[model samples]
Target: MRTIRIPYAELPANARAAVEAHTGPALKADSASEGLNSEIAVRLVSRTGEYYVKGRRASHRWAWTQRREAEVNPFIRGIAPALIARVESAGWDLLIFEAVDGHHADYRPGSPDLPKVVDVIRRLGQLPCPTIELRHAEQRLERYVDRPEDVAYFAGDTLLHTDWNNTNVLVAGDRALVVDWGWATKGAPWLDAAFWVIWLIASGHEPASAEQWAAQVPAWQGATVEGIDAFAVANAHMWDEIGGHDPDSWTARMVDAARRWRDHRKA
Candidate 1:
């Protein structure tokens, strides 16, 4: 793959200076896009620890998103990776985080740590963020909801980890930590729960087991099981929009789960 390099001159002076100070010989780096931001990773050696310095070439919109997470992350420490430092250089924003120590959840499924994965989602829901309104999964669904038939059905909100794929979750020891907060938005908590259900099933759990686990997620004081089911359906539909590559059997299973949840909601 071709890689682009960020010149030191293009970064903020403080950030450039910090990178130079830490990375003795000005190590080679690569630029890649992770979701919406231009991301760059450079190797750096420092007295604090060996680290991969990462920055997102800031766009007007994503800059605020990055800054919001940087602001909110410090308060939600145990739930996220530790923030090492922030670097502002030449119109660019860089976030240096304590490198998490584990592979993405995709690599370690059969290790009996699945429940902890569910636990992290539930715990994040329980956190009280009065200022941060959760992004509704319904809004995300509406982006792909092309028909009036779909519109009336997806008219609610929940806290959603817009990207709940296995790749974004990291498993360490007995715990599962969710990373890549760029997509974290408030909506129906069930939207996140439902998406995770699909993820768990795609990762090889039975549909019944996935649904059972999802159903057991404790209500976060203001959410409901019915709301979760709606979120699940919307989540599945959104996944289909994004061209999810799950096998037909997996998609069928998700459809079945959505139907069952919908029927239960109606009853």
Candidate 2:
């Protein structure tokens, strides 16, 4: 569910002051419209510099995502926006990031951004999971798996950016950078590529075509056929629950996409 957005100007004076300490006097605070999380999402411009700031009430159920993003920033430097500061003040948790000038990636068939995104996935596969707090892939998906023991196929040490929607990826120059580390997971090296397959399917790729794209990632070759099939079945259940069986929603579309992949794997 989307949080009720709070305007930057309406933030408590103390909280604004805390943010200004790093940004200097805020000349402008442009609220972002794209993200689902973060009640407070904005681009701030000051005489000193520009930044992307996002936050939630410190007591909000999902506030832990703020801390998670901050903790993982250092480990994912070049592939993501740099974290400038983490501010906790007046009952809010805020994270400031270096402003990135880019557009959300295009995932349509034959889009050039596809290769850039695939390249980033390749680099991410080579990155070692850091020793910070991160959810295990199996633990996160256990409730949705076809069988209780199927979760073991997802266990591994690779740092996985489990969310693959276009909004979470930004393209600039010759590169595509991923954002929103809130769902970062420690999982099998090939799982991230597997995750990308559903999004590709949602964006209009056939199951076979989407698998072809996922195959571009070196780690995709390491995926066991059984593991991939298990993931497809588990993800379909997960999306079904998340989308609440609503046929009009993106989650519903993802459910359709996941089921297609699951059936394709079986075939």
Per lDDT, the best of the predicted structures is 2
Query: Clashing residue pairs, candidate 2?
Result: none
**What's the lDDT of the predicted structure labeled candidate 2?**
0.92
Clash count (model 1, backbone only): 17
Per-residue lDDT value at 137 in model 1: 49
lDDT of 2 at 262: 86
Off by over 4 Å in 1: 1-15, 20-38, 42-44, 60-64, 106-109, 144-160, 220-229, 244-267
Task: Provide the overall lDDT of each model, using Cα atoms, as 2-decimal numbers.
Answer: 0.57, 0.92
Mind giving the per-residue lDDT tens digits that candidate 2 earns over 1-267? 678888899889999999999989999999998876888999999999899999999999999989999999999988999999999999999999999999999998999999999999999888878999999999999999879889999999999999998999999999999999988999999999999999999999999999999999999999888899899999988887877845657667888898888888888
Error in Å for residue 54 of model 2: 0.3
Instruction: Write one digit per residue (lDDT tens) for candidate 1, span 32-107.
Output: 2332233465444455555545666666455565665566665456667776777676666776666666766652
* Error at 76, model 2, angstroms: 0.4
